[model samples]
Target: MSIAWDDALKVGNIEIDADHKELIGLVGDFETMVKSPKSVTPRSIQITLERLQLYAHDHFAREEYIQAIAKYPGLAENKRQHDALRKTLADYIAKFEAGQFGDLGKAADEMAAFLNHWLMSHIVDVDMKMRGALSDEGWR
Candidate 1:
């Protein structure tokens, strides 16, 4: 699938929104990588996956920091969600590395679906709740 970033994913905060955009781009890059496993080397695939995972971790931290600064009441819940996301990513990576998906192409499709769905839903259902955050000051 041709996954592209959309403005509808914005969560009101500029920093958070920017991270979401980058995350979407990373997901797209990964989707492309997995779609054509022949054109990519194993090392290149590893690098792309590493970037995706590391960037996600960094984004979660940055988002939580912004929420903390704004004194968001849902900060605790947000952190819990972040923890779940991290765990889910780790589990999927482990499965992929262990050859649990049978083939790279199948794994690719599953990963893309999970990343796209999880990111979109989290941003919409959870992060969007902070659109009118209490304290309402600049978080940057």
Candidate 2:
């Protein structure tokens, strides 16, 4: 199944929803790069991973800030989830730098697949919860 972000996946707030859409697009792009017949070099993978890292960092901070302002009850859990993912992404970046993957192509493929699965699950299980919680607190 493709990792997608659609109108039905919206989580009430426009900014958060937009962030999710961009993140989904990024994941799809990374997966496409992995599946491409073109030579997937370590440099190329690093570039995309770096983009994802920066984007996720900003998105998570924005999201958590909103959640804090709205007094969303799930704010703590959201922070925990975001931090965990950040660590995972950082670990992958470190592994890439250390050339520990042996087969960069295979490692890139694995990370792409994991990102796809993780993004969708996170949207549904964690981020989506913010819709109701934010609404309860009269957040947009």
Best by TM-score: 2
Task: Write model 2 residue lDDT over 1-140, tens digit each, in one string.
Answer: 56877888888887888899999999988888888837588888888889989999999999998898888888899899998889988987898888888776788778888788778767888887876566534654
Model 1 ranges off by over 4 Å = 1-3, 40-42, 134-137
Off by over 4 Å in 2: 135-137
Clashing pairs in 2: none
Candidate 2 least-lDDT 10 residues: 131-140
TM-score of each: 0.86, 0.89
Look at candidate 1 and tell me the lDDT of residue 29. Answer: 85
Q: What's the lDDT for candidate 1?
A: 0.77
Q: What clash count goes with each model?
A: 0, 0
Model 2 TM-score, 2 decimals? 0.89
